[model samples]
Target: MKTETIGTATFETWTVAETADAFARDEIVLIDVRTPQEYMFEHIEGALLMPLSFFKAGKLPGQSDKRIVFHCGSGVRSERVCRAAIEAGITQIAHMEGGFAAWKAAQQPYIGTNMATGAPQRAPA
Candidate 1:
């Protein structure tokens, strides 16, 4: 997909490794745009929980200038979230190419508390 910028926010897309690199350098804020229940299942390490519905409800709680990389279960919802962020005037935005499933397929690490059992699980890299 073509990456476009809106005002001060630039939509720069990236692959899993590229996203991970940005996270490693502390240059991007990863936001999990999935539902709270899905987020509780598992998510990329260091990603913040910000449901897409929350943004749709006009409850964005972060700086617009922050570099945001959004992800969902398999990238569908996250893509919608990125578009919404752009519509909401967030210029610097991106979506994980393949979402959490892709991250897991790539053997990337993740952490989360089990929703059903409340047990914390850390995926092994």
Candidate 2:
């Protein structure tokens, strides 16, 4: 991961390809900071939910050593979340560049449907 300094805030960033590769290898954990509804609309498979609206300034779920890669609609919110995590003393933190938009643009495999329904449905055959 590469480092960049923006005044008092500094965090690492990963491109879509890098993120996908890391995810494929189980090298990093993806955290989606978008709203639950937005997440339900479409999101990367296996990502943990930590919506910014209900975010707490502390360690997230899972082990401390795992790398956490935060992402949102357009990378803005996730950056804020990452900074907050940093302030909260989380060292292994990163954010996806261009956020979920880039991932969608890249046509990466994701899970979700635009239609909102509570009924249980069969998985794709």
Candidate 3:
């Protein structure tokens, strides 16, 4: 992964394949920064919900392991949260490129919603 560095933050844009592989290996903490409603509809399996609305660097989970990755419906909010973490002194972080849309597009399996019953469903079939 090519690391993107700015004044203070050092983050990387990870592809869906890379993200999934890392998650499968337990190499990072995958976080979903989308709204609760959005998450309820669909989300990455095993990803922790930490909506951008109230996201705080100190509140982030799996910081001890040193790999916390954020994602949203698209890349926008996740990147915003990444910058916020940088501003809050967490310089090293990452966000999934293209976010969940890209994940689905790449055919990476994830937990999705069954609109008819509003039940969670595993997808990519």
> Cα deviation in Å at residue 24, candidate 1?
1.5
The segments of candidate 2 whose C-alpha lies over 4 angstroms from its true place after superposition are 5-10, 61-65, 114-125
TM-score of each: 0.79, 0.81, 0.92
The per-residue C-alpha lDDT of model 1 at residue 77 equals 85
| C-alpha RMSD of candidate 1 | 3.3
Deviation in Å, model 1, residue 63 alpha carbon: 6.0
The alpha-carbon lDDT assigned to residue 53 of candidate 2 equals 91
Give the 10-residue window scoring lowest on summed lDDT in candidate 1.
Answer: 57-66
lDDT of the structure predicted as candidate 3: 0.88
Comparing 1 and 2 by lDDT, which wins? 2
lDDT (C-alpha) at residue 92 in model 3: 88
Cα deviation at 29, candidate 1, in Å, is 0.6
Pairs of colliding residues, candidate 2: none
Q: Tell me, by TM-score, which candidate is best.
A: 3
Q: Report lDDT (CA) for all predictions.
A: 0.78, 0.82, 0.88
How much lDDT does candidate 2 score? 0.82
